[model samples]
Target: MREEFGSGAAGGAAAGAGERGPVVVALSGGADSLALAAAAAYVGERDGFAAAAVVVDHGLQAGSDRVAERAASQARGLGLEPVLVRRVAVRESSEAGGPEAAARDARYAALARAAREIGAAVILTAHTRDDQAEQVLLGIARGSGARSLSGVPPRRELGDGLVVLRPFVRADPSITRAVTEAACREAGLDAWRDPQNADPAFARARVRASVLPLLERELGPGVAAALARTADLAREDAEAFDAMVAEQIEEIVEHAEAGIAVSVAALAANPAALRHRIIRRVAEAEFGRELSREHTLAIAALVTHWRGQGPVEVPGITVSRAGGRIEFARRTGSPRRRRGCADGDRAEGGGARGVAGTPEAMEE
Candidate 1:
């Protein structure tokens, strides 16, 4: 791992404290996460803090409970004191889309629930540099602007009473795996690997096994590192842009029955880039889903080409033009929003790809 990249090496970075509650570590039985749980233990030991591990079994496949149980045992061995493992039923709700996204959402919800139960401040996840880079790529492929390109945040507010932290966003997954392997060897334990990683049924799998490897071979050995660095830079810039947008929203956003309504007239007056960002921002708040380019364009069309009182529905949400402004609200407004345009939890997957900082000592 590069020294310039903080938190790249095992147990290398200092603890970041900000709006932290009951620290809940999300352990997925993957090397990236196992190492994170162990690191949390180390941090807890050093900081006089007692941490708990939360493992969510999504029931996506058979033998999942066995995996979750193994993760709980590992967390206990790592000195988490009492690791709490729970299995959540993945219903085919908007929140839990397919097997992959459903599992992720359920896991996060379980962690948040546990955090609330314990009054924890921060929920830590082991989203590595590689993951961040892949996210950036996904975001780019989806044509999300700079905000989407920024990738994963190191720390940000999640649900109430909890701010998610990715201390290892700059860390190399290879390094995390190495650390986990070392721990496994020393403890005479087995580390679990997700078979889906090589299943090739998902976009991420293709990116990992084919696209990224090709990029690395054709571009250079440190292509993933470069992508991650780009994401870091993008993240910084995107955050700044979002801050500015928030300030602008105050001037143009009006409270409405749906949610926050945007002044289309005021929006038209802004710069083109700001216009697109504002569109994305408003959609983000309203639907909480990743609105695609087509969706944004449809909204923009109302400003440019629509006559009067025509209903426009985007995936997950609806936009109505009355007077001279655009209103963004959930389509169903059925109290519970379905994922799509209205369900923002799914988010924009391809926001940024995380690159590995450099895992240690690899054997062919």
Candidate 2:
């Protein structure tokens, strides 16, 4: 697990902190996070860095505050200093992706606030191999692309100077949730189990309780490990493609009058895969909208199969082929509009693909 922190921003933050700054752990009173807190306490003392714990109460369930306090007390018992409990309101109905997403967003926001207030060097999360495998399965069910299938990232920049590290998820052999439970038991910590994790109404709980077990039972063992491995490979491929896009985007994309334009010739020169990525990237970066597969392919046609088509209107952007360039501008008035071209002008014969970095991509 220590080797997992040896590279990346995790190592840099730890080394830079010396003895002045602390490493904060997000403890949920669950086995996974509790084990992480235990490990951090030992590692922080051994390496001469301060360790702290934060427990976020979403206020969705009864007795949530008590649960948060219990977790914070356990952290203190483990010798973590400055244990804190944060309460956040989660507006589940108003959030676009439903309750689970709302809770996650609120939780992270609280954690980030705690880290910033403490001037912490790094924040640790307890996502394990099982979580990674579940994410991949969820992505598959959504018919998502490589980025979604890549699963949760091990290290993510949470803006400011804060970084969130998931040492368990990135462990070389991959740490399982069971291992965390065992660790808590050995350390004599009474871990709290969240009821939502076992609730059938939640998609993740369904996947964890049924889908994964059935696959393992029928196909034999190691299915979860295989899925996690698939996420690793897919992430590598997605990162490479992202780098390629970044390298060429400056040369091919430029700002237009009221929107952005991509050189149609350059787009047509690249393969279909790269072309779709560039198109999606343009929409996301410029307009803050995610292009669905149908919309993406429709825009791709403006460059590859141009036949004097007018403009193609997606959910929030209007795409057109004009003067040897593909132009994307904000859509006004009615959300659906078509000019000159027939409804069948869209590029055809492709399955649904989720745009990377969008909520739809990371459904779980």
**TM, every model:** 0.76, 0.89
lDDT of 2 by residue, 1-364 (tens): 3334333212333553565479899999999999888877776776778888999999999999999999999999999888999999888653245666677888889999998888796888888899999999988977768998999887788887788888777775557888788878888999999998899887788899999999999999999999999999999999999999988798999999979999988999999989999999999999987777778888998887888867777756778888988999897655442444344323221123212333434443
lDDT of each: 0.67, 0.80
Task: Summing lDDT over every window of 10 consecutive residues in candidate 1, give the lowest-scoring window.
Answer: 355-364
Go through the candidates in order and give the clash count of each: 36, 0
**Deviation of model 1 at 266, angstroms:** 3.0
- Give the winner by TM-score: 2
lDDT of 1 by residue, 47-89 (tens): 5666778888888879999999999998888877558888898
TM-score of 2: 0.89
C-alpha RMSD values across all candidates: 7.8, 4.1
Which ten contiguous residues of candidate 2 have the minimum total lDDT? 347-356
